[model samples]
Target: MSDAQRICLGAIAGAFGVKGELRLKSFTSEPEDIAAYGPLESEDGALSFEITLTGQSGKGALIARLSGVNTKEQADALRGVRLYADRGRLPALPDDEFYHADLIGLEVFDTGGAPLGRVKAVLNHGAGDLLEIHAPGMTASVLMPFTREAVPTVDLTSGRIVADPPEGLF
Candidate 1:
């Protein structure tokens, strides 16, 4: 899919209750806002769903109901399905904030314009997001902390990032 078309907001964990309720794992900064983007579509664009937040559940997930999902078995069948919203439906971010989708695939470069790698993914595990760069000439990908000190500049227009990685992290 083209990067401009969609942004993955979350996944359907499974059916929450018997009455079509789904366990939604939201990837938004405000978990509850996942429903505001309107109907979410499957990756293949074959299926689409409108989310209605019923309430909050364990692990900060939301118990939601999707249109056309009425049975526990039906919801169970959607487990592990990633949900995406149209790019235009999402709100614009502040200057310093960026959607992970926008960062993925951006090229990475050192201060001297040396190619480092391409961004494979952006990860956040309690700490801020880290840029997982798929550097060539390396056995494994490099995990560079996505901090201002490390990633000094991100030029989305150029589709590249200028990084001042920590010593020996290149």
Candidate 2:
């Protein structure tokens, strides 16, 4: 029932051409595989879409058509909506890999067990995922590199992360 358990696959960028085609921005590693996960639901779980990839576009994004969307206006209307899939449908990750959703709510702590913060989000702007941790008593959130050196341990079952943050990052 918790929407937090789902992984965002992509988003509906609204209708592409006038023939009901959609502009889909895939968030998957293999961009074209967005359709392979089957129907994706809206964040609020209010709507579901069945996507069929038609072809690729200029920016590594795909032009697709959805089951119910058929017009450029319709596609444009859905421009910024994010799409999500059931967590179970996603492929299993390697031992050292993890989905961003799995780390979002994990408690962050120092090597000495001092509470630091909770993960607010994971950001990846080409290099790698960064853990955005939000802690009490701090005016601003901290952006910690999610690498093995900085975040040494991520125990999902325990809902906690042990971070060896850089000096002054605390």
Best of the candidates, TM-score: 1
Name the top lDDT candidate.
1
The alpha-carbon deviation from the true structure for residue 151 of candidate 2, after best TM-score superposition, in angstroms, is: 1.1
Q: For candidate 1, which ten residues in a row score worst on lDDT?
A: 1-10
lDDT of candidate 1 at residue 49, scale 0 to 100: 94
Compared with the true structure, the alpha-carbon lDDT of candidate 2 equals 0.87
Model 2 regions more than 4 Å off: none
Taking all chains together, each candidate's TM-score versus the true structure is 0.92, 0.90
CA lDDT of each candidate?
A: 0.92, 0.87
- Scored against the true structure, residue 120 in model 1 reaches a CA lDDT of 95
Clashing pairs in 1: none
Tens digits of lDDT, candidate 2, 1-170: 58667899887766667887877888788888889999998899888899888997776679998778877787788888999999889999997888888889899999999999999999887788899999999989999999999988999889999999999997
